[model samples]
Target: MRLTRFTDNALRCLMVLGLEPTECITVHAIAVRMNMSYEHLVKIVQRLAELGYVETVRGRHGGVRLARPAEEIRIGQLLRHTEENLTLVECFDPETNTCPIAPACALAGVLDEALTAFLDVLDRRTLADALEPRQQLVALLSRSLDPPTPSSTELAS
Candidate 1:
């Protein structure tokens, strides 16, 4: 199953934070580095803060850090939080799904199993696990921010 944009960005944010455990990363800084909209990141950060996934510190020096250790932040937990619904079919949704034969639908059961299996695999991993090769991840993220070396004409300006 495909993840939504919210989940994708949340995972990216967590990965970036995982790389710099010793530093508190400002939401603005993360948004800039990730090439994401600052306003969107602000909302995402606020949600994360409310969920106890990340801690927000207020003030000029304020920023965010993982509320718990990277090791403790499980991948499945994030997936669960980020996903609004795991239903693959209309019948999977109990409220709106009024399929006439939902009680006998093997398709729905199979889909449910698939979703659970997917989460089960992710559940075995943590944010720390996802952050392997973190130095490389940091370098990949920081590349866009690197200042280009000026040529003579450019330097004059």
Candidate 2:
């Protein structure tokens, strides 16, 4: 079961916010740091805010921050909210399923069990768990904030 880019970006956005829990980081800054489209990140942030996962501030210093502590943000719950469709197979969605053997397909049951197990693992984890390597993540993300240096070949020209 693959997650959509929307969910992926949402996770990335949350991880960034989790890095600076007390500070309100702008969506643009997150986009730049995460190499995401600003407009796309905006949509993700808006959705997260509406879901009570993020708090948005306004004005000159306005930006976004986590609404709750990272430890409280369960990965499974977030994924369920962010993922539009959790259906792992065509049979999972009866409305659009055109499989002739869907009615008696054991594969569907197996896949369903697999999907449940996948989410179950995520359910046991939280944003804080993902951020356990805080110092390492900070170092990597901070590198993106630095201005790019000219290549050796460019310097020779």
Candidate 3:
């Protein structure tokens, strides 16, 4: 099953914060580095702040940092918060199920098992897991802090 872009971006935000546990990174910078929309990242950051994943400070120097340690931030839990829906098929959502064979569909059960396995694997991992080889991640994300330059394709356009 494919994850929504929102979930993917949320994970990226968490990774950025995880990379610099002590520093408050701006949503704008993350948007620039990840090539995402600032407005969308702001909303995601707000939701993450509300969920107690990231802490925000408001002002000229205001930005965000991880509210909890990276090791404590479970990937599955974060996905649950960021993903609006995890239903892989119509039969998965009780309120919206309209399939004729939902009542007896073996495929639905198999899909359910697959979903569980998927989340279970994620559950075993944490934000820290995503930021492997600490030094390398730090360097990579540090480079991301630089102002983005136009790509060759964009320059051509």
Candidate 4:
């Protein structure tokens, strides 16, 4: 039931972007804010952009921003996109399954139902729902971190 680090980072990146919807924040800044590796965040951002979750701008003043409103970004949809493998059990993937009792395993069906129910709950929620406590999140994020710095070009502009 646990999500991968890639999905985790993607969610965190979206939350940071949601915090400043009108502005483009650099990947480096996001990495700093989220305490994530810059390199790892870059890959996440690239995938997110490819999935149309975020838009990227290039150049010295370039940064990233949400492609759509937080309310339109469903958590379940995002999870489905970010998660490379959703297979909870070996039997979930027929091609690679090595389970000897997969054909008769009732556990697979039960696990599948549980997984569906989990995603169903997330389907009902959106990024906006997660960010409902905006002020609280902002306060906590700012408590120990300095404000993200603008690029040199952005400063000149």
Candidate 5:
């Protein structure tokens, strides 16, 4: 049950935003801190804003902030917004599927059960639960974000 990069980035962005002490955090800071391309994150922020997950403020000193509290934002809810489909197999969506073996394939049933289990677990977890691990993540990310010093070999060049 691999999540798409889009979903992954969105989740990361949300987590970063959640980590901030202030009510809002600039997109530039978020991108720089995470070492992510600012251009791509723009789209993710726009989409989340449109979905009412994050609120955006314009002009200087303005940025994005969470639309709701971390505990209030359930992981499953955001996942549904970010993901296009949960189809683990062709028969998962009847509207677009015409597989000949879909009717009686044991594989479809097994996959269906697997997907359900995966979703059920995610559905049970909230962003608040995920935030508990932030202490370690934030420390690691903060160190990684520090500007690299030129090594002796690179400086010689």
Candidate 6:
């Protein structure tokens, strides 16, 4: 099953935060490091903040940091929260499943099984597990230490 770019960016943001849990990092810095758009990353970060994964602070020194420990943040849980749709096939969504053979589709069952297994594997992993040997991320973030922050007008609005 393929994850949407939105979910991918969420995971990347989580990984960045996981790598440096103590320091708050700006969304612009994360966007720069991950080669993503600042605007798009802002929307993703808003969702993450709503879900309690990342905490945002406003003002000149405002930025974001992980709300919980990386080891405590399960990958599967975050994926489920970040992903709006997890259906592997059209049959997975009852409202959209128009296949005539859906009632007896063996392929749908198999896909369901595969999806379950995929999530199960992620369930066993945590953000910390994804960031083991964090030197690379540490270096990336260190270079972003002085990136521009959103202006007060931008943050206030």
- Candidate of highest TM-score: 2
Alpha-carbon local distance difference test for all models: 0.86, 0.95, 0.89, 0.93, 0.84, 0.89
On lDDT, the candidate that comes out on top is 2
Pairs clashing within candidate 5: none
Give me candidate 3's TM-score against the actual structure: 0.87
Better of 2 and 3 by TM-score: 2
Q: Which residue runs of candidate 5 sit more than 4 Å off their true CA positions?
A: 155-157
**Sort order, lDDT high to low:** 2, 4, 6, 3, 1, 5
lDDT of 3 by residue, 1-157 (tens): 7888888989998888888889887899888777789998998899999999999988888799999999999999999988888888998888989899988889999999999999999999999999898898777767877777999999999
Tens digits of per-residue lDDT for model 4, 1-94: 8999999999999999998898999999899888999999999999999999999999887899999999999999999998988999889999
Candidate 6 positional error at 63, Å:
0.2
Candidate 6 wrongly placed segments (more than 4 Å): 140-157
Instruction: Compose the digit string of candidate 5's lDDT tens values, residues 1-157.
Output: 7898788888888888887735688888888877788998999999999998889998887999988887787788788899998888778888989899888889988888887787788888877687777889789779877889989999999
Alpha-carbon TM-score of each model against the true structure: 0.88, 0.97, 0.87, 0.89, 0.88, 0.86
After TM-score superposition, the amount by which residue 23's alpha carbon in candidate 3 deviates from its true location, in angstroms, is: 0.9
Global fold similarity of model 5 (TM-score): 0.88
Candidate 2 per-residue lDDT over residues 4-49, each given as its tens digit:
9999999999999999999999999999999999999999999999
Candidate 5 Cα RMSD (Å): 1.9
